[model samples]
Every structure is written in C-alpha cells, then in structure tokens.
Target: MRAMAYETYGGTEVLRETRLPLPKVAPGEVLVKVRCAGVNPVDWKIMAGGLDSLMDVVHPVVPSWDVSGTVERLGIDVPEFAVGDEVMAYARKDYVHGGTCAEYVSVPVRALAAKPASLNWAQAAGLPLAGLTAYQLLTRLGTTADDTVLVHGAAGGVGSLGVQLARAQGARVIGTASPRNHDRLRGFGCEPVTYGDGLTERVRALAPDGVTVVADFVGGVLDTTLAVLAEGGRHASIADHTVLGAGGQWMWVRPDSEDLSTLGRLADQGRLTVDVAAMFPLSELAAAFTLSQEGHASGKIVIEV
Candidate 1:
C-alpha cells in the first residue's frame, strides 16, 4: 500500500511517500480501505515529537487519527460491522502508529461508527476527532439551555464544532475569533468576540453576569477564561493543562463509537456540519501538515486517499 510516513521525529521535511505492507488486523479490529483522512494539529505535533512523553512512537509512523473509509476486512470477534460498510473512526490506539494516512488502516471495532449520510467523504473524515472533542467537553461541562457558553479559538476545527454543539443544547453561545471569522460564527447563532486584547471586556459586554461555561480550544488563554467565567461556572481545556491547577478539567478526546454515532446523527439532522478548509492527495501529506501548522485554517484539513 502507498502511504506517507516519517521514520524520525521532525517536520514536514521528514515525511516521504513510501510503500508499506497492509496493516494487520487484530481481534476485534477491522481493516479499512482509506477514502479520506482528517488532518489535525495533533498530527503535525506528533510528527515533531510533541507527544513523545504521552505516546510511544514506532518508526516510519503514519500520522493521522481521523479516518472515513470502508471496511475491507474484519478480524475475529468483530460483530458490529460488516465488510464494505462505510465508516468513520477516531482511530487512535494506545501507541502512536498505523494511522489513517495510508491506503489501508486497521481500526479497533470500539472506535468505528457508520459515516453520516449527509456528509461527503471529506466532511465525514473531518468529523471524528474535532467533533468528539467538542461533544465530550460540552457534555462533561453539563451545558444547559440557561447557560452561556464561551468558546476560545472558535474559528478553528474543534472550536467550530464546540460552538455548534453548545448552540444545539440551546445554550447562548459566545465565541472568540478574528474579525474575519466573526460573520462565520454568527451563521451558527454564536455571538462573536475578538479573542485577544481586552477579550475579557468583550465577553463581559455580551454576558455581564459572566459566562456559565468556558471551553478553551486554544492554549494561552487561561487568564481570559478565568476573568470572564461566571461564579460557579465550569471550564475545560484541550490545549492547556494548567487549567487543571485552576479547578478546570484538562481533557483529552477518546475514541468512542457511541459518541461518533451521535455526531453522525447530528449531522444527518442538520444540527451539525463540517467545513473542510483544504484537501490534499495521499502523497501530499507534508503539505497538509504544513497547512495545519500554519494555524490559520477556519475548518478541518483533509487528505483524500
């Protein structure tokens, strides 16, 4: 199978297209013929050894966790899906290896969900990791209709979904982004606020009583988050671990079939949508990684296999 991989931790310069044997399917796993792979900031982060302490890296690592594909084969005891079923997964394993950037990837059955019919291959591929991160954060914070939710980095992949999911819960949503993305947030019924320089004042103008919940997708915003949060409010961050020291949850997204399925249903019901910022062919994985590292994309980046 043709794939792009890096044998050592480095930047896009280390990524090269190479031929690799098809991944072996373990019990309770399924081999998926990759249709599209979603590229997240974490993909590039992992490529550069950003997660060296948290995950073990295997040589020649293929570096994406989000996949939308069809089942080419199933392993023993996997009764949940049939061969040929279109699926999407947050395919992270205990170790860092055998990712979705290849022609084929072996995903554990526990991480698989049927792809949403309303989405194209690119959108489907984009949904799993970012969607699930937003969903889990909102769900864990117990956002309710009466709550006013503030989302940091609202124009980026995970933050975009976080705003939508919070809005879906009937919460009044406030999101932080650049002026260019303010109009985009408004389309999702979110009140837009500039993220830097007097961010607290801007958010306060919208919710004088302070926000009832804060979801931080961008790091280095804890001071602003704490300043605008209402008394007794809940908060969490996927980027900043120091939130843990301030009585906030520091979260990591997990692969759950049920959660991914709920995201699919939301997409089908028109309550959620994926915006794809760019798409690259399999051999151009390095270009995709470079784009993600640039940190300017307003939506998910995808690799079409």
Candidate 2:
C-alpha cells in the first residue's frame, strides 16, 4: 500500500510517499479502504512532536485520525458491519502509528460508524474529528433551547460544526469570526460577531445579559469567554487547557461509534452539514498539512485517496 508517512517528527517536509505492507487488523477492528482523510491541526502538530509527551511514537508514522472509507474486511469477533459498507471514524489509537493518511487503515468497531448518506466523500471524511469535537462539547455542556451560546473561531472546521449543532438544539448562537466569514456563520443560523478587539462587547451587545454557554475552539480567548458568560453558565475549550483552571471543561474529542452515528443521523436528516475547504490527492498530504498549519481555511481540508 502507498502511504504518506514520516520516519521522524519534524515538519511537512518530512512527509514522504512510500510503500508499506498492509496494516494488520486486530480483533474487533476492520480494515478500511481509504476514500478520504480529513486534515486537522493535530495532524501537523503531531508531526512536529506536539504530543511527544502524551503519546508514544513509532517510526514511519502515518498522520491523520479522520477517515471516511469502505470496510474491505472485518477482523475477528467483529459483527457490526459487513464488507463494502461505507464507514467513517475518528481513528485515533492509543499510540501514534497507523493513521488514515493511507490507502488502508484499521479502525476499531467502537470508533466506526456508517457514513452519512447525504454527504459526499470529502464532506464525510471531514466530519469525524471536527464533528465529534463539536458534538461532545455541546452535549457535555448540556446546551438547550433557552441558552444563548457563544462560539469562538466559529468559521473554522470545529467551530462551524459547533455553531450548527448548537443551533440545531434550538440555542441562539453567536459565533466569532472575521468579517469575511460572518455571513457564512449567519447561514448556519448563527449571529456572527467579529473577534479580536472588543470581542466581549460585541458578544455582549447580542446577548445583553450574557451568553449562557461558551465553546472555544481557537483558544486564547478565555478573557472574552469569561466576560460574556452569564453567571452560572457553562463553558469549555478544546484548544486551551487553562480553561480547567477557570471552572470550565478542557475537552479532547473521543472516538465513540454512538456519537459518530448521532452526527451521521443529523447529517442524513439535513440538520447538519460539513463544509470542505479544499481537497488534495493522497500524495499531496504535505500540502494539506501546510494549509492546516496556516490556519486560514474556513472549512475542513481533506486528502482524497
């Protein structure tokens, strides 16, 4: 199989297209023929050793956790899916080794979910990680119709989904983004507020009393989150761990087939959607990584296999 991998942690320059033997499928897992892989900031960050202390690295690491593909074969004891079933997963394992940026990947049954039929390959590929992040954060915060929610970095991959999910739950959403993306957020049924200078005031103008929930995807905005959060309101941050010290949850998305399936149901029901910013061939994964690192993309970047 041809894969984009790196033998050492460094930069996108280290990624090389090379041939590798087929990944061995463990019990309760399935070997998926990759159709597309989603590019997240964590992919490049892992390449740059951002998770060195938290995860053990194996040489020749394949670097993507988001996958949308078809099950080619099932491992022992797997009874949930059949061959040729279209599926997707946030395929993050306990260690950094095999990943989705390849022709094939082995994903556990616990992480696998039927892909949303309404989404194209690119959109399906992009949904797992970012969608799960948004879903888990909103669900954990117990978001409801009466709440006014604030989303930081609302135009980016995860934030964009968070905006939609919050809106789907009937919450009034105020999303932070640049002027260019404000209209995009509005289309998702969110009120857009420009971030940066006076972000708190802008959010406050919309919520008046204060936002009932805050979901921060782009971090570095704890001050604004605190300023606009209503008393006794809830908040969580995926990017900033310091939120733990601020009476807010610092969350990391997990791979749960049930949660992923919920997202798939929402997509199929037309209550959720994924925006793909760009697509690159599998061999051009380095370019995709660079784009994710640059951090300007308003939607998910994907590698089409």
Candidate 3:
C-alpha cells in the first residue's frame, strides 16, 4: 500500500510517500479501502511531536485520523459491517498507526458509522472529527430550546457544526468569526459576531441576559467565555484546558459509532452539512498538512485517496 509517512517528529518536509505492507486487521476491526481522508490541525501537530508525551508513536507514522471509505474485509469478531459497506470513521485507535492517509486503513467496528447518504466522499470524510466534536460537546452542555448558546470560532470546522447542532435543538446561536464569515454563519441560523476585541460585549449585545452555554473552539477566549456566561450556564473547550479550572469542561472528541451515525442522520435530513474549503490528492498530503497547520482554513481540508 502507498502511504505518506513521517520518519521523525518534524515539519511537512519530513513527510514522504512510501510503500508499506497492508495493515493487519485485528479482532473487531475492519480493513477499509481509503477513498477520502480529513486533515485536521492535530494531524500535522502530531507529526511535529505535539502529542509525543500523550501517545506512543511507531516509526514512519501515518498522519490522518478521519476516514471515509468502503469496507474491503472484516476482521474476526466483527459482525456490524460487511464487505462493500460505505462508511466513515473517526479512526483514532489505542494508538496512532495505520491512519487514513494510506490507501487502506484498519478501523475498529466500534468507530464505524454508515456514511451520510447526502454527502460525497470528500464531504463525508470532512464530517467525522469536527461533527463529532460539535455534537458531543453540545450534548454534554445540555443545550436546550430555552437556552442561548455562544460559540467561539463559529466559522471553524467544529464550531460551524456546533452552531447548526445547537440551532437544531432550538437554542438561539451566536458565533464569533471574521466579518467575512459572519454571513456564512447567519445562513444557518447563527447570529455572527466578530472575534478579538470586545467579544463579550458584542455577544452581550445580542443576548442581553447572558448566554446559557459557551463553546470554545479557539483558544485564548477564557476571559470572554467567563464574562458572558449566565448564572448556572455551562461551558467547554476543545482548544483550551484552562476552561476546566474555571468550572468548564475540556472536551476531547471520542470515536463513538452511535454519535458518528447520528451526525450522518442529521446530514441525510438536511439539518446538517459539511463545509469543505479544499481537497488535496494523497500525494500532496504535506501541502494539506501545511494548510491545516497554518490555522486559517475555515472549513475542513480533505485528502482524496
């Protein structure tokens, strides 16, 4: 199989196309023929050793966790999927080897979900990690019809989905993004506010009673979050752990087939959609990673295998 792998923890220059043997499918796992892969900041950050202390990495590590593909074969004890099933998975394992950047990936059945019928390969690939993060966090916060939600980084991959998910629950959504993206956010029922200076004040102007939940997708907004939350309001961050010390949850997205599958259902219903900013070929994974590392793409960056 052909895969772009990094020999060491370093820059995009470290990634190179290489040939490797097929990944061994373990019990309860399925071997997928990769059709598309989603690239997130964590993909390149891990390549640069950002997660070295947290996860053990093997030599020549493959770099994507988000996969959309077809099942080629099923592993022993795996009964939930069949050959030729179209699926998408947040394929993070007990460790980070056998990623989706390769021609084939072995994903655990527990991480598998049927792809959203309305989405094409690149769009489906873009949904797993970001959509899961948004869905899980909003669920944890207990957002409801009566609540008003404020989302930091509203135009971002996760934040964009968060806005839709919150609005689906009948919550009034307020999101922070550049002025350019404000209109995009508004298209999906979010009231968009510009980020940076006076964010709390801007949010307050929209929700005078204070927000019922604050979701931080961008770091360095703890002050704004704290300032805007109403009494008994909940808060969480995927970007900042400091929120934990301030009575907010620090969430890391998990691979739950149930949650991923629900996201697919939402997409199929037209209540949710993926926003893809760019697509790269498998050979140009380095360029894809470079774009993600730069932190400026508002939508998901996908790799077409």
**Model 3: per-residue lDDT, tens digit, 258-298?**
99999999999999999999999999998898888778898
* Per-prediction TM-score: 0.99, 0.99, 0.99
Candidate 1, position 179, lDDT: 98
lDDT, candidate 2, 1-305, per-residue tens = 99999999899889999999999999999999999999999999999999999999898899999999999999999999999999999999999999999999999999999999999989999999999999999999999999999999999999999999999999999999999998899899999988889988888888889999999999899999999999999999999999999999999999999999999999999999999999999999988888888899999999999
**Backbone clashes counted, model 3:** 0
Ranking by lDDT: 1, 2, 3
Task: Please give the TM-score that candidate 1 achieves against the real structure.
Answer: 0.99
What value does the lDDT take at residue 279 in candidate 1? 98
Candidate 3, poorest ten consecutive residues by summed lDDT: 289-298
Clashing pairs in 3: none
Worst 10 residues of 2 by lDDT: 199-208
Residue 287 C-alpha lDDT in model 2 = 86
lDDT of 1: 0.95
For model 2, what is the C-alpha lDDT against the true structure? Answer: 0.95
